[model samples]
Target: MSIMALTPPPIPRDGPLLRVDRLRQWFSSGGFMSPRLTVRAVEDVTFEIGRGEILGLVGESGSGKSTLGRAVLRVTDLTDGRVVFDGQDVSTLSKRQLRPLRARMQMIFQDPFASLNPRMTVGQIVGAPLRIQNPGISRSEVEARVGDALRTVGLADSHAERYPHEFSGGQRQRIGIARAFVLAPDFLVADEPVSALDVSIQAQVVNLLMEIKRKLDLTILFISHDLAVVGHVCDRVAVMYLGRIVEIADTRTLFRNPRHPYTEALFSAVPVADPSRRRQRILLKGDLPSPLAPPSGCAFRTRCRYAIPACAEAVPPLAHIGGGHQKACIRDDLALQPAC
Candidate 1:
């Protein structure tokens, strides 16, 4: 059976299902006085996922989306800020205190093959969490729950005795999903769940996620670079860049009218189906900045077409722009092109 990197915990019945306040996750290297460098993977990010909300986190590679996910789950400790899950402060919880709560929070890793234990049977993989959290549970009960979870993910019962190596990529991912859902977790962090799958398989998995969310009443943090997938499955979207969120709004609002320059650039790249509506790609100037030493003031100022002298003076706050839409860019006069 696969083991979690760190045991997680649970929360209360009210408030935003998950509230992240000024969360920062930083890692330092060179302990032996080699001019230690710290990678600011997640810096002062704040967001909320209400009950049964699938909040999509969209960003380019190395933008710190995964790190933020792990930190929110307390799979890794945070360097600063607070993470409140279900009203409880998971960041302050100890391992012993977190273990029982682990059953309530789960993670769906990006690589289906790597996340599962190749040597273990599917039943073992799915039943592991129930056994760990409920050590007193009967063997038959574990088997029953495992079977149900497998069925829910569209796998047959006989396949439970088989190993992950015996399945296709999609089936392996289904097994991973079975394992994640077996615990009936209240909150899930699905990190690039469908990225490794084919286009067709991606739809199947995404549909499965939507169905399961309805069945489980789950609150999810759906992290992906695929804006199309995010648009289809997410209620709201938050765009991340250089370890910070640049824009956040309801899916329709953000897709129809992105306020941040980075968001506008990102949306412009997404392929539109209709030939009549070709989006002019807003090609970015350079690669992502190094997380170790990010640019000053506006991290995106170097590439932003609307950047000015004041942009390099201080970091722009993620401020409300009206009607629940929020943006980090300081300029409010420039009109951004609508991608779709």
Candidate 2:
């Protein structure tokens, strides 16, 4: 491996909204101490989000994107590593200490219909977090705050009185968004926020989120498998494969000049409008290996066309190519090219 300069400006920690470092979350199936088999849901992932910036996490179904998002939120137990939010290490925080931090960090799950409580009205759903965080707030104040939150997500105050089933899918998702933002959290982990909506409504929700981020000065970690969707709202993008980050760069740089073979394959999958023009699709071979027994070197090497013998001997560390771009592939000759 050759050493290259990592000169991109490091994420400012002075007041970063969120910082995750070498986070690893593993699940044990059944293994003796000798072999130590475990499913690495998230392994050695690191990134940062500025006060109001959106950091997109993109990957295939089992690439551990959602796991990383949940891990940072401390919703799931991490096997090891640190997650610092607003300068506090969440992993080490006691339940009592973590409770206070919940007021500043929240999550918006992927499924709108499923995430909402069918038994509760919209107001109750949105106001639950507020009540838990600040019990001293009056009932009248809770209603007022719930109204404001509903209005913020494009819903009327009266809508809060109705049940979630009464609303459409997009509208339910809006309620979910309202619930997450109701607490006025500084950081939010939005896992596939738009993937479940209609294509037309997807833009509406995404635009709403972008607007909310700007207006409220909120920081977000947007997780999605849709590259185009991620590119639309994220300031920077991180591409994951088999529980590890293979490439990360600014949104424009990642889309226009992806530097990882896996990232290139993902870009090629995005559908285009014109039927007359066709692009060569790079077909990857083999299924993604189980994280418990992932390949010795690069996790993607099993399906990578440029894989060499050296790729099997040692894992490739993330190396800077240029700008803020970084990749973990060994084959320089197979550097990623843009989609035509």
Candidate 3:
């Protein structure tokens, strides 16, 4: 059967506002003469985001957190699996079919400077989505919405006339936020929205996102490498390693008692503010494996301290331990120490 013929029907909106099931995205590399290599950017990733909930996708660089976010939003085509948003099965929607849904689902990109068009003024940048999505709307109404959006992100109306280059890094991010929010989206994929800003300004942007989420009743998939930031803003956290979720739980639970070896290592790396409460840094062996040729069985087996012989035989399926906490490790003897 053709890919479109395999598309599932729209799901009920009564459950999670966003549901991604076994989603996979792969990129092909090498010429026809050479052996084709598939870079498994996202593989068998499954999760759900309830309405008005913020689910943080935390992983190190090259862990495919960003790819998973893009795949979920259908910004890129999926190699396999399904993505259901609100009540629609968006996994198979053509660009023309997805046009109407575009306004409801938006993304705040990682690079503020690159994401916004330098040629466009702040007002034009933020108002462009409104104009494209609702072409019949009056220009006056667009201006009103743009003003409100700028104000929402703590930007002044006068600033709207300015170009992206004129703003500070933080200010540029605020402009990006204004652009994403002006569409009045129900779902947003914030892919490292604060990663490019100053440490001092990171908190400010995060706070703005929190405020906007509350005000708009938004369901956000927050993708970031900073566990500290994720812990602060997200209701739940899903830890990804080598394109697969290794552990998932409520923010408090996951941080307090991480189960998987990779998840534990990640949490241990978070710097403790209190010198008295210093943690033993878990230094993993080697760097992240290349996605083009990921190791068989558990992708993390090579670096995982708790890996057994069985870990190399087959990938461990995610299993619930307790209280909505789940881990993919085969070992049952491991658990993260309670946080100080």
By summed lDDT, which 10 consecutive residues of candidate 1 come out lowest? Answer: 3-12
Better of 2 and 3 by lDDT: 3
**For candidate 3, lDDT tens digit of each residue in 178-295?**
9998988999999999999999999999999999999899999999999889999999999999999999999998888888889888878888888787567889989999998889
Give residue 25's error in model 1 in angstroms: 0.1
Q: lDDT value for candidate 1?
A: 0.91
Q: Per-residue lDDT for 12-111 in model 1, tens only?
A: 4678989999999999999795989999999989999999999999999999999999999888878999999877888878889889778888889899
Please give the ranking of all candidate structures by TM-score, highest first, separated by commas: 1, 3, 2
Q: Best to worst by lDDT, what's the order?
A: 1, 3, 2
Estimate candidate 2's alpha-carbon lDDT, on a 0 to 1 scale.
Answer: 0.88
- Model 1: residue 68 alpha-carbon error in angstroms: 0.4
**Clash count of each predicted structure:** 1, 0, 0
Using TM-score as the yardstick, the better of models 1 and 2 is 1
Off by over 4 Å in 1: 1-12
Give the higher-TM-score candidate: 1 or 3: 1
Query: Whole-model Cα lDDT per candidate?
Result: 0.91, 0.88, 0.90
Q: Pick the candidate with the highest lDDT.
A: 1
Best by TM-score: 1
